[model samples]
Each structure stands twice: as structure tokens, then as C-alpha cells.
Target: MRSPCASCVSPGVVKVLIEPLSNQLAKGQLDFIAECLHGQESGVMATVFKVSGEIIAKVASRLFLKPDGTVISNIEDELLVQQILVDVQQVLNQGESRVKSYILPSGIAGVFLEVIHPIVPLVVFGAGHDAIPVVNLAKHQGWHVTVVDNRPGYITFERFPNADQIIFSEPQTIQNHLDLNSRTVAIVMTHRYESDLALLRTLLPSSVSYIGILGPKSRTQRLLQDLKSEGFLPKDTQLQRLYAPVGLDIGADSPEAIALSIVAEIQAVLANRSGGMLRARFGSIHGEEITCLMSV
Candidate 1:
């Protein structure tokens, strides 16, 4: 069980706890050592669990901050590693808990590669019909999703069941309201050209990790041209690197298939892929080509 001290439990001191598990041992004793420390009672608990072939990292920083309230998983992920600060907010917001149980996860050795994911947070700009599948895919693929939309009906909790946060507000207002950073991703699939362009214009100049347009290449290009003409030339590499007609060219026509493509691009980007072929490309492989082997 873990408890937060009032001093350290504030709007600060959210550290990423690195509890490395021991290896090269026949005994399973040392691998499950539970340590507890009270340092000004800061609001943050990052627990590492071993499940089968993966090392699950659970982070609880907001809303559902508890010893067993949330967990990180491939299917039922708990930590929003992309939004570590948000998770910290949840943890710090825990205020005072009499009993906190920070349990450790179990697993065997000789498995998957060492995953070093950036602390980038993902914020989906639309809570439309596509938002459902999109958020689900995002969760499974390990992303912190914030579903935003203008219509209150669509932004309801029931509509976005798996969404971490359902925001009902204009895209422009919401874009300026959040703490968007370099590790943040904005997916525009709201089906409204104006709304999509509005958010993209605002976020394009920031340090966002990715900006994916949910339309055709020509349309995206036109939008870009329009924005540039309006004196909003997003000069950042991320903006300049926007994935238009978002998703892999899988000839996807349905919402589900389209969602797949969009997520595919994100996966490619996350895996550091250039969306190209290794044979056609050059020598040194720092992306999908060489990275795949290194992961294994």
C-alpha cells in the first residue's frame, strides 16, 4: 500500500519511477520486492509489471488515481505515458489517501525487447463516429487520447466509452486550452474542413509530435496552401511532416478501414518509419528496416 505525504503531494514533483526488476536468478524472491517511500508525499506512482512477453508500465496521475485503480496493458492499458504530466496531476490530485496499494506485476525472463517510449501524449481532435475505433486503437497501441468535439451530443461519456477524456467544445477553444507539447499528437477527422483547418493551424506551429489529416492528399495540400496564405505557415518539422489522406494507402474506404490506415501511419511514425521501402531507400537504416530486427 502507498500513501502520499501532504508536502510532496501538490501540483508538482511527479517523477517517473523506474523500478527495474532483477534478472539472472533461479529464485523469484528478489523480483517481487515492494519498496515504499514517502517524500513530501508527491502525487505520482509509476509501477512496472511483467505480463507474459511485455513489461507493462502503469501510471496513475489523475481522475482514477489509486493503488489498483488503473494499470497499463496492451489491451487494458492504465498509464497514459504520453501524458505523464496529466497522470501526475491525477496522482497529485489524490490529495490524501489513507491506504494505497502499489502492487507489482509478475512475469518470466527472456522475452520482448526493451521499450523506451517517449512521454508524448496523444489528443484526438474529434469525437465523431470514427473517434470510437480511433480511440480504441490508440489505447491498445498505447496512447493517451483526449477526444474533443463541438457537439455536446457526440462528446457525451456514453459515445466515447473508452476515451480518457471527452471534451465538448469548439476545436479552436479546446486547442488553446490544453497543455499541448512536442510529444502531443492531433488527429483531425471531424469531417469539417473549417474545424479541421482551425485546429491544425493552431497546433501546426507548436511542438506537436504529429498532425494527421483525415482527408485526401489534394484536400490537405489545398488546406496547407490556404493556411500559408493566411499567414499561418506551420514551419515545424512535425507540421511539415503532416500525414495527409491519413493512414497507409490500404485502399481503405470505410470508417474502420480508414481508421486502420490513420493508426498505421502513427505506428509507422512511432516505430520511426519513413513510410517507404528499405530496398528503394538508402544505406544507413535508422527506421523500420533496421529497427525491427533490433527490437527482437
Candidate 2:
């Protein structure tokens, strides 16, 4: 059981708690968060709070909730964690943080659920001069970026200092080097006709969320026609995820400006936006504003 006074946290006092299994050693919440990021795992951190007055609330227990319904905390009682599992999962699925009040054994408790998603994985197929700015911008956005090229001289750590991984692989052998997932976004800009064709043949059928190909519409159409002639016909749904002539229409003439447009388009795709002007839309900039949950 958690201590009743646990909720009465003082200002500037850090209240951190975690409990490992009987055989495992204990770790702090920060360490656990680091582990999650390192492993590319998604989870939620739930912090319980006690409503002290009209304007203030105090921190109580904190727990980490995994997608498999496992809870990690020092609280001896498992009932509270179990009771909030459904709500936690809902918030996690929405990919949005939320706060909800609950009627607890002690009193009305507020659980602030923070959704921790994995760092986005971006694979740049070409390590050319243009790809440099793309890699730099993605890293600035805190994405895990991988640079791939068949040219032994091109795929070097010196060339891509900020890249998390630089792979020296051709289009035929690229699949072995990549760990493609739904969260992964790929950019194709090898500048070679055969290489782009081979890469598109592989990427179009995979679960990668977005595939932005750097070329003109006619070039992309020719690649698709060639791919179809090779009997690797992609489904309509797969083609829908393809963004040929990539990047938003920002009149990007320079490499840096083009990189910005590409990065912004990727962000918009992930957020399910159409890359339109925000000033044209009404309401809050980020969809909906957070509202206080009614105390039960």
C-alpha cells in the first residue's frame, strides 16, 4: 500500500519511485524512460495526484504502464493500477497525454497520463549533398536517422556525422540492413534511375508510414511503369502512402530550403495534416485544447 502522506508532496521536492521484480535490481524512473527510448518502446507514465485545494494539487504515486498491461511501481496494492489500465490504454492509443480524476480508496485522485512514443526512424536512401541537409534537419527534430548508399565512398561517418547509422548497401541488399516498421519514414534520392526503381520496388509494399521520393512526377511515373513491368505491382493502398515529387510547395530552390520543406511534410504526414496554411484554419493550432477532468 502507498503511504497516505505520499500525496502531500511539497514544492520543489522530487517524488520519484520505482520497484523492480524480486530478482531484479531497482531503477529510477528516468533510467526506465531511457531504457524505453533505447529500445524504441511505447508506454505511458501515470502520476497520481491529490487535489489539495481549488488551485493546487500534490503528487502521489507514479507508475509506468506498458502496452501489455504490466505496471511498474513501488505501490504494494495492484488494484489501483488495474483499475486505471483501460483509461491508460485509451490515452496511449490516442497518442495524446490526458488527466483524469478517479474515486480511489483514499480520496479523489488525479492521474496524469503521459504518452511516450518511440523516436521516429528516418532512412535516407541517398547520401548525396542534398541528403546531408535532410539528415541534419531530421536529427534536429530528434528523429533516429539512417543513411544508406551503395557507393563505398559516400556512406561514411565523416560525411554523415549526425546519422545514427550509415549503411553501405545496394538496393538489392538494403532490406537486410533495415528494420522497417510502421513508424519508419523513408526518403529516396539516390539520383540513379536503376537504384530508385529497385528501392521503390522494396519500399512500396512494406509497412513504412511515408515514402517520399525525390524526383519529378514524370520520373516517378516512369519508375512505377518500370516496376510494374518487372511484375512487382504495388497495391492502391501502398501507392497512396507514396509521396513522389516530395516536400511541401514552398518554392524550395536551395538544398536547405528543400530540406526544410521535406521535413515539414514528413511531420505533417505523421500528424495526419494536409500541409496547409495554419492561418486558414480555425480553432486551436493543435486541434483541441486540454480540459480539466471532472472530479468523481
Candidate 3:
């Protein structure tokens, strides 16, 4: 029996894009769409159908409309897809969810676009007391959060009722339990030198977009030096993505204050902002344009 298409599935979707009807596309195009959806924060589903109700082509929101109202994807029907993508992009820009329909020149009337923003995922690498505030702050923002620590005593659901997942595992073994992708924001605050070093070694080689290490700048420098001595020379690109001395310099001393700073910094980074005063910055506070599927 043939599998049902993504649109035929039930209600209440997760942060995933499924396109069972995409077998009509080339393998390379399918791969590109997969990569795009893997990094998107706003969930998107686009289905192209014939007037007879047969699904023709289907794709998710990994493609975004450029400022000039064009898209950069390898999918077929670029013009029609671009038009539909523009409509989806407008909904995302307005921070709303909606279903939109369009008619193609072929007289197909069932072409539809559905877009929904998913909760961002955040993984905290330490379950220390300081992590509580971070978890609380992130949960308040409606982000999917996971907290990891090796000590069973330190990482308990009682301490983190809002956390989606609490894993008790060694720093080196975290990859087995958690999957880090381009949209994941990882924060390391184990407060142990060895654990932080191990986590950094593991994360720097992965595709996780943001790696925030809590501590002093000098501490991070020392950690890098140690990693270099161990023959782990991080690439320039990887080093650039690491945010040492995590959180903004808002004179944060208490745990809650620090949490605020850290979350603010992460939000700014996700939005491609400099975390500067809005009055000093030009253009829209949301950035000049929405960069869909671009690396965080």
C-alpha cells in the first residue's frame, strides 16, 4: 500500500516537515529541502495538487522569499512555489499562523501553504543550581529545553519541572542521548573544567549553530589552549560560532540576572543582531530581512 502524504496526517504537528509526495523530485532537490527544513524555526508545509485532487509536488518551508520576492531552492515550479513562499513569508514576518491557498495557471485549485512557528530548542549542558534560572527563563519563552548532567543527584525532574528532558550522562556520552542540529542552541555551564572541556571538544566538531560557554573569557582561552595542546585545533568557523563568557554584559551578578542576559544574547544571535541598544541601531529591530533557513 502507498503511504499517505504529509498533508493527510493528523492535527497538532511538531517541529518537523514531512513531504511523502516529494518522490517526484530529483534526489538532490529532496536532500536540499531536507537540509532547509532541518534548520527552520517556523514549520512550513506546501502542497501542490492537481484539479483532480492528486498530489503533484510537495515541499516544506525551508525555502524563503528573497527581498525581491524570489526563492533559492532546487524544487520544480519555481515561480509558483515562489509565489506561495512569499505568502508564507508574510505570515512568518507578521508572527502569525495561517493557511493560504493559490491557483496555478494549470487551473489547479488545491495548492495550499501552511506555516506555523515552532518552539525553539535549547540544550543546557549542566544541571547545576545556576541552570535552574536558565531553564525557567527558557521555558517562559516557550522553548523546548533539555538539561544534561552526569550526576544523578544534580539532574532531577523535581528541580526542573519545566524541562522537557533531563538526562544523566557523562559529558562525552551526551551525543548518544541528544541530537544536535543547525537549529539547536547549546549552553555549557558544568562549572567543572574537565566536563566543560569534554563538552566543548564534542560540540565544536558538530553543526550546532550556537555554543555558549559560561565563565570568564580567560577561562575559555585556557580551555582552547588545552584543546590545542591535545591536538584539537578548532577551525576558524567553529571558533567564531562559540560564545565564550556567555550572556550579555548587563552587570548580571545573580543567577536570574545572568539567565536574562544569556537568553537575551541567544535571542539576539538567533535574530542576527549585535545585542546592542536599539536606539543606536538602524533599520528594523527584527533585522533588515528575514533569513529563512540560514544558520543561526
Top of the candidates by lDDT = 2
Model 2 gets an lDDT of 0.77
The C-alpha TM-scores of every prediction are 0.56, 0.80, 0.64
Model 1 per-residue lDDT at 149 = 86
- Pairs that clash in candidate 2: none
Give per-residue lDDT, candidate 1, residue 38.
Answer: 15
Name the candidate, 1 or 2, with the larger lDDT value: 2
Off by over 4 Å in 2: 1-26, 49-60, 74-83, 103-107, 288-296
- Highest TM-score scorer: 2
Candidate 1 on 15-119: residue-level lDDT in tens? 222233335321221111111111112223332222343425432121222223342222233432344334344434532222122332432211111122333
Over 1-296, each residue of candidate 2 has an lDDT whose tens digit, in order, gives 22212221334454333222222322455565665565556787776654433322235456788645577764433555666677778877787766666665655566667777778999999989999999999999999999999999899999999999999998977889898888899999999999998899889988999999998999999999999898888899999999989999999999999999999999999878899998998876655333222211
For residues 50-75, what per-residue lDDT tens digits would candidate 3 score against the true structure?
Answer: 23233234443234333333445533
Q: Order of candidates by TM-score, top first?
A: 2, 3, 1
* Error at 268, model 1, angstroms: 0.9
